[model samples]
Target: MDNDPQAQTLIARFNKMKEKYEEVERFGRYHPDYSTIMKEVRVSKREMDMHETIAAYKIKETELQSFLDEISQIVAYSVSDKIMVPMDGALFKDGGCGCGSGGGCGCQAS
Candidate 1:
């Protein structure tokens, strides 16, 4: 990993949060279940909705953490590769990014 302090802190936080989220999901999956019929169900509808909401949020958080992990990997590799470029050029368009054609900037205006 790169020696950058900010990157290290972010990666650590993301990893910790991701682990906690996984634990919650595992608990939900292992919880006991019961069959239901036209008579009635034990769990309240509102309680079920809340549980579903929490599960959805956990799923999204895990996905975002996975993306952050991939970015950290790329950054570490880039530092080792010694490949560098101007920040501005890497981010902003140079206005002539495309010409009168059907590709690039797609400015054919046909």
Candidate 2:
């Protein structure tokens, strides 16, 4: 979120960790501050991923991707009579829902 202060803070903190890691990355496996900074960077990344807005966005993004994939299959089925359809059948497959729209069709393909 462009205007989200908390997200901005986390991003800045993560960037700082990146810079610190760069300073110590040349050291071998036992670099003390490198591990600490890397751990902090990972934690910061997880925090961003778990943020409420970001988490919701990711869920919706996944659903949208599924819908898009279903549509792509549906389009191919329309042109191929199922010949070009992937083995991973969607509702567009025969005896399936025949509708890619997630409209609570109550069909098993859903």
**Candidate that would win on lDDT:** 2
Model 1, stretches more than 4 Å misplaced?
Answer: 1-50, 81-110
RMSD of every prediction: 15.4, 9.7
Instruction: Please provide, for model 2 over 1-110, each residue's C-alpha lDDT reduced to its tens digit, 9 standing for 90 to 100.
Output: 66778877777877787787777787845687766777877888788888876677778987887788788778888888534444343445544653654434645553
In model 2, where do residues sit more than 4 Å from their true spots? 15-33, 81-110
**Number of residue pairs clashing in candidate 2, backbone atoms closer than 3 angstroms, sequence gap of 3 or more or interchain:** 0
For model 1, the local distance difference test gives: 0.45
Could you tell me every candidate's TM-score relative to the true structure? Answer: 0.29, 0.53
Residue 26 in candidate 1 has what lDDT? Answer: 64
TM-score of 2: 0.53
